[model samples]
Every structure is written in structure tokens, then in C-alpha cells.
Target: MMDYKEQREWLQEYLPQYMTEHLKDKNYSHFWPVLNAEWFKWLCFLTFPLILFQQRKILQWTKLKSSAKCPKKESTVFNDMLQPKRRAKSKAEIYSDIYYNKRIKPLVKAEEEVGNLLEDEDEDVKAQVHKMYEQQWRTHENAAKTNVLDDDEGDCMLDAEAITQGIDDLSIICQ
Candidate 1:
């Protein structure tokens, strides 16, 4: 087995070279600052879809000749996640929608019922959601601390909900 330093150096040298070849471009030297070993590893991982596509083309040709077929299945992680396996939504997501409807919607409706003077209601709603999310996370953290050894109930399951909500919010914001 190689030592840690040697293994790291080997990876640092090999990954970029491998990416450059797979990408079929020699003028990628300028891409070095943005592309790192981790990015190269991700690229390597994502090549499975390309391979599957190529295989599908070849299989189509053979299917025409021998009447054989390749069974189609979801291949990529993104495709699988987007396929909607009908899992239940977490409490944070449900609660975020509920709290927004309960708290923020009324404030906006009340503003609407009165007049359109407050132009910052959108900002107010965003602030309320942020504050509520922070409070939820704090509550999870406190509960986790208090029940450090209670692995049966009220352990740290709430943290997962908060994290799922954070991820959902991030995906929305990114889009």
C-alpha cells in the first residue's frame, strides 16, 4: 500500500490527465483553477450515463439483427430521485408550508385587505421563514443535547427534517 502523501500526489497528477484525455481537449490548462481533483472524480463518476447511451445504440443495432432486447431501467441518480417514488414529505417541509400559510399569508392578506402601502411584504415573509427555520434548527440542537443518550425517542430525528428543509430551500433558491 502507498503512503497517504504518495497516494495524494498520484491522484493529483493522474486525475487531471485522465480528465483531459476523456474530455479530448489539450487546451484545458486554463481550466485548472476551476477544475480540481474532486471535480475530476465527479466527472469520472458521471461517465456511466454516456457509456450506457453508447451501449443502447449498439443494442439497438443487435436488436434489429437477433430480435433481442435490453430491459430499460432508470440509470442515473438524478433520474431516480426525480422519478417520484411517492415517499412522504418530512415535517420541516410540511411545517414550512404550514407556517408560511399560517403566519405570512395572513400578514400579506391583512396588508392586502387594508392597502398596498407596504411594498416590503415579500421581504417580511422571507424574514419570517428564515427566523422560523433558524428557531427550528435551534430546537433540534437543544433536544439533541438534552437527550444525548436516549437513542429510542427524541434523539436527533428533528435535525434530519431541518436539513431536508434546508436542502429543499436551497434547491428552490438555486433554480
Candidate 2:
């Protein structure tokens, strides 16, 4: 069967003259050219609803005897997900990745970096700072063994006021 474009092409030769003659009485001048080709085009378009109905009837007409092929959709290329999935991932993997990543490595790296920072200090301050890190490393080691090293820890180095208050509080508690 011929498609709408083929049917429209055949009618287009004769329909323009018929439409222009019939619609010329209206006040609109701009619509004449559009209506010429559009009338048959629309007539063909109107047939599509019927054509679709016929297609459905044909499906039912030969339900048991005939096979028809339907159009296939192209499969999409999706990226492999990153480590932290947007949805529906294992929970233990999240905590395990962070236990090593966000917690342990940065703590150790910051402690090492602070030693690098102390290299620019006066010899007296550098010696004292190095000694402080030795004590901190021992505390960190013990904390690691106990398995109670805080997951909530940030940047490893204790704040100055907290360190001072800790020493003062220790002295008070000792007395």
C-alpha cells in the first residue's frame, strides 16, 4: 500500500484548484495557499486513525496465522558506576572504604606533614615539636590496638587549647 506522502503527491496536482475555488469568499487572503495543499494532506492524515484501526484489525484478523515484526529500540551505553553508587549499594563496602580512606591515611599523613612544618621552626621549638609527635604516635598506636580510635577524628593533631587543658586537667587530677 502507498504511504501518505505518495497519496498526497497524486492529489496535490488537482486538489489545490478545488480548494482555492471553494474558499476564496472568506476575508482571509493568507490562508489560501496553506489550505490548497493542506486539505488533501489533512485528508490523508485523517486516514491515519483509520489506518491504525485497520492495522489493529489486521493484527486480530490473522492472530494465529501471521507474524509481524515490531520496531526495536536501540540499547543505551551506560557508564560503569563509581565507587560510591548513586543508589542500591552494599553498606559494609561504604564503611570499609571510609575506614581506610577518610580515617586512617589522613591521620597518619597529617602527623607526618606537621613534622615537615616544624622543620622551618627555631631549633628549640623544632626539638619540642618532634618530641610531642613521638608521644602522639605512641598514643595513636595504642588507640589503634584498642580498636576505639575515633572514626569521627579530624586531621589527627589535637587543638592547642585542648592539649593545654588536658595537661592542666591531668595535673589537677593527679594532685
Candidate 3:
């Protein structure tokens, strides 16, 4: 039955008291320190950047001292540390390396020989060798087609032989 003004005044006075009493209950007592920790939060916020700055200054000083003490040798220590150490090559890896080296040697040698031949001053010799290569390539291509048509089983062997012969002929011509 209180009038509006009186009700408002009563609530204003009573509400704060009610909240304080209830908020101190055992159930909510633990949350009070955390809820009131604005100063602690500000302390942390201010100190974090200071901590980082000090660390950076320390690192810089250490680096300057190191450089002054010794000229930096080509240090692979850190590089080796950062990179994973390689294990001894496996049998398969060794075999594959050997196979590739053997396979690549001839091609590299052939390239060098061809480079030498191209450097030769005689245009007629280059022309005759080119003609011979073309003739051999055409013959190989024709033989490959005939072998493919006549016998599927022997096609791979024939192609390999043709390639070997072509390489031999090229070596002879280059020499």
C-alpha cells in the first residue's frame, strides 16, 4: 500500500543492504577477491611489456659481447642443430645413387662431346654427322613400329637394343 515515491525511497535504501548481505554468503564468498581484482589485472598489463623489453635488451647485449669477443666464424652449429640430422644412406638409397650416377655419366659425357663437336670449325663434318644421325633415328623409328606390330613380347628388348646401337653409333661419329 506504499505510494510510488515512498516505494522508490524504500527500495533505494534497502536494495544495497540486501545485496551486501546476500553477496557475503559462503556460496559467493570465493568470487569477491576475483571480482575486485582490477588493480592486479592492471599490474600484470603494465609489467608484461617491461618483462619483454628487458629480455630483448639482454639478448642484444649478449650478441654484442659475442661479436666483440670473436669474429663470427662460418658457424654451421646452429644450422646443423636446426636441421634434422641425416641418417646413413640405406642400401636402396645407395643403389639408386649409384644407378643414377652410372646412368647420368654417359649422358653428361655425350653432352660434353657434342659440345666439343659443335665447337669444331668444319661445317661439312657437322653436316655429315647430322645427316647420319637423322638416318639412324629414322631407321630406329621404323624398326620400333615394325617390332610393335609383329611381336608385342620382344618390343621392349628391340627398342632397348636400337637405343644402345644408336648411342654407340653417336659415340663413334663424335670421335
- Give all TM-scores, in the order shown: 0.18, 0.23, 0.29
Give the winner by TM-score.
3
Better of 1 and 3 by lDDT: 1
Report lDDT per candidate. 0.58, 0.59, 0.58
Better of 1 and 2 by TM-score: 2
Please give the ranking of all candidate structures by lDDT, highest first, separated by commas: 2, 1, 3
For model 2, the superposed segments whose C-alpha errors exceed 4 Å read 4-39, 42-120, 143-175
Q: Which regions of candidate 3 are displaced past 4 Å?
A: 1-84, 89-114, 148-175
* lDDT by residue for model 3 (41-116), tens: 5334343545566435533543454344334335368777998657888997787787866787788889899888
Count of backbone clashes, every candidate in sequence? 0, 0, 0
lDDT of 2 by residue, 33-127 (tens): 65545644645545355766644543353332221322123333453433356777578767767697768888989999986886778999978
lDDT of 1 by residue, 64-174 (tens): 532222222326688777787687889987877779977888888997876654344788876887799999999999997887555665554567889999899999999
lDDT of 3 at 27: 43
